[model samples]
Target chain A: MRDASETEKAVRLYAGTVYGIALSHTGSKADADDVFQETFLAFHSSAKVFHDDEHIKAWLIRTAVNMSRRAVCGKHRRAEELDENMPGGRFEFAADEQNDIADAIRALPEKYRAVIWLHYFEDMPVKDIAKALGARESTIRSQLMRGRERLKELLGKDWFEDE
Target chain B: MNKIFEDMKTQAMPDESTVNALIESLPEKPRKRGIRFSHIAAAAAAALSMLTITAGAVSDWTFSFLGDFSSAFGEKTEAYNIVESASYSNSASDMTFELVGVSADVNIFRVMLDIYPPEGTEFTEENKPCMNDNITFDFYLLNAHKGYGASGRFDVLSDTPQKMRVMWTYSCSAGIEDREIEFVAKKMTRTKDENAVNTDGNSIITDNEGSVIKTEEIWYTRIKTGSAPQKVKYEPGGQAIDLDRLPDSDERCRIFVTSAEIGSMSVKLNGLIRGDLVWRDSTFTAVKTDGTPVGLIFSGGSTIGGEPSSGLKDGDIILLFDDIVDPADIASVTINGTELVFK
Candidate 1:
């Protein structure tokens, strides 16, 4: 029921968030592109109306998570390791550091990586992140703590201390 | 890490051309018109067709029934055997309710309806009208048939800011034999200023918790159940269970394991407990040949003529399992300690 103009506005506003979640979850641009297209098509066709910008964002995030999970579950796609060449890999940080951090995140399990991306990268609070991912806040906290520890080990002591 | 995300925000978004292309592919929005049932009656029919097309394009299958209804009835136009179709307009609530179609058979009676609200109406969690608590449909047989009355619950096939498409299914004690059915809606209330909450933004008022604060004027509508133009028999594939073999249990009065498709199973149950108690997620268990327990992924059902958990009489239930990788792998299903084995 969302008009084209409203949908365009939504795409302009949240395309990065949706694509970022998909890319972070799948670790591949091809899969990310598929998930991105599906997510927006769903938004345009969705019957549920949004209350505010926050609800729209949350719904898109939730849809992205669900689509990413389905994409992973359906097939055995080749998972490319996150590196300097990956989409969104070239950050403000040094090349090696960014690659290392990205690799560390990508190496984590899907559950942990999802929580970490939503929590640290997206700046989402634990409660909202839990709602978005349809998990308990406690579960999100647990995953965040464990994911961070795993990142610390992967990034080494010096890199960890710098944070 | 934050810097990485900021960079991701800049680089990961889809380009403008991709967004434009996607927008171009979507169906154009229907033009806004006066709130009249007759005006959008044809649009509602088109919406039903669009529902099927949309379901196929989108992967989310939550509303698959809408698509199924369109395909199953559209082709055999005469198979649905629609009994009646009625439209009502409530100027006070600025809403229109139409009984689009109704079809009945020996076992099941189904009703399809479309509710059109004024433009700009919102349907968010806080703003969405609580259909379960506020709306009630009282169905009665006009010609004095076998059953006392029809009992069933409504499931929303699609909901938008403009219109909500819903399907109601009931277990009929007898078939429609030249008998007419009447649906009377009672005490229908909608939330007017749902966003009006406490200053802290909590929806709960200071004194009235879980109670309607600012209620819109009450409206009621009576419409005859529409007869589907044709009578279509929908037969799902899978293994059927022998009714006599189902074990005895206090929770379930009687259960018919009708079919087991690849990843899902359907059942009709009359539970022993009171209230509209449909099957719970924890009530059933499935296992594969390797003896690994399969988790119940989803369970959906509609109650006939009672409140949820008010005990079940008879209703259609669909159970989807996590370990149903292949239909051939299913070993057995245990419901309330009564196991039904499959060879």
Candidate 2:
């Protein structure tokens, strides 16, 4: 088991990314909590030693992805109707367009949502995302391209750049 | 998009209290000095609760229901009764396997096997089966009397240098008796890690996926399944809902909350009109009397195949809540805005 200080530091650093990945995949706060708890518990109990913080982060991200997949594929897996009208977060956005964009991101297919969040939100490169997801970089690129297109379509032509 | 992403990142996370509670719940780290006193105490408590048979030779084994890395078995194995035991050693593979125990139910069958590597064998990061994906087990079940045989999916519950615990489960056919059963364990092959590649100076290997894969035979053994537990019905209280009277709804159905257990809950939705009925995504919430939301442990659904416009259809939906709830504490259940009081 990890020391209390170490666990606290790691949790504080990666909690957002982990929870975001869970929420992106699950689309439900309750499911995300289960993923978050399981991921951390696994980390605490893991016997593998990390070489550095990047390795730790990568392992946690990968574990989070795997756990989210298991949760989605679980026997009790259910489709929870997402409330598109609900606020994305506790705080109000400065611009209403931001909320629209957030909702659009959430509305994307599960496969696309994780790649988009990691790439655009987490600022992780395609290679890292590929390594984290145990997939080829080509797959990540394809997902990013397709996810961007879907997001643009949902937000309308005026909302996205033509690149 | 970047601005939106940034704004979203600023959203709230689980508070510190939750994190602290999780850290506290974690099992104590294994002591560097062989075995600690606390380890024995905790193991004794766990063994007592699990009702596990502690043989003289295997007195050191610690059984846990939490399914942590230190424990040889999971909590689910506690429900099973040990019916058979065998010991086999493979010189070629430098391993010894003991068919420590077995358990079964009507719908599922479980086997617990302890694997021991030869002395001086170091279970390092490079050789650990779980981390390296180096080992695999092929399991088979047979009933010669009835001439019924099939393979089952095997899973490694926990692994350690001292011993590795493996469990497998498959659908149990009717009329299959424990006395007539024969379990077969085929030798496993240790495959080379295909992902391990030389990266030169770069931290990441670009073409690692193209690496060659190779395998060599390792350990193998089989043992009979001992006993099976009686099938128990897990029926939770039921609640009735009139689908026609649901808020903001055109469809009509009668739904009942069937069972609620740790990590999962089930509901039976029946008597649907079934015309153009799309089983689209729906949300269900279990709330306390004060309307505080109870966390859902798991979320999944199974579709009951039925003809459209059949005038009557039904489906069983099971939602896994995060924790068990007291029936009395539950005020109501809301599915897609349709609220129904507990029966």
TM-score of 1: 0.41
lDDT of 1 by residue, B275-321 (tens): 12324323677677899878765444433322111122224343455
Model 1's CAPRI class?
incorrect
Question: On residues B1-343, what C-alpha lDDT tens digit does candidate 2 reach at each position?
Answer: 4555677666625556666777677667643532111111000011101011111222322111111011111112112223354444434222333333333332232232322233345445433333112112222222111122222212221223233323221212111211111222212221244542222211110111322222121122122222211122233334445453221233333333322233233444543211112123467787878888888643323222121011111243444444555444666567767665444
Best candidate, DockQ:
1
Q: Write the per-residue lDDT of candidate 1 for residues A1-163, one digit (tens) a residue.
A: 6787888888888888887777666666666677788887778766676788888888888677656654543333235534646564433333556656666776776567667777776778889987565454886888788888888888774232214
List runs of model 2 lying over 4 Å from the truth. A70-96, A157-163, B29-343
Each prediction's DockQ against the real complex = 0.15, 0.11
TM-score winner: 1
Per-residue lDDT, model 1, residue B26, is 66
- What are the lDDT figures for the candidates, one per model? 0.43, 0.42
lDDT of 2 at A90: 25
Every prediction: chain A TM-score = 0.80, 0.76
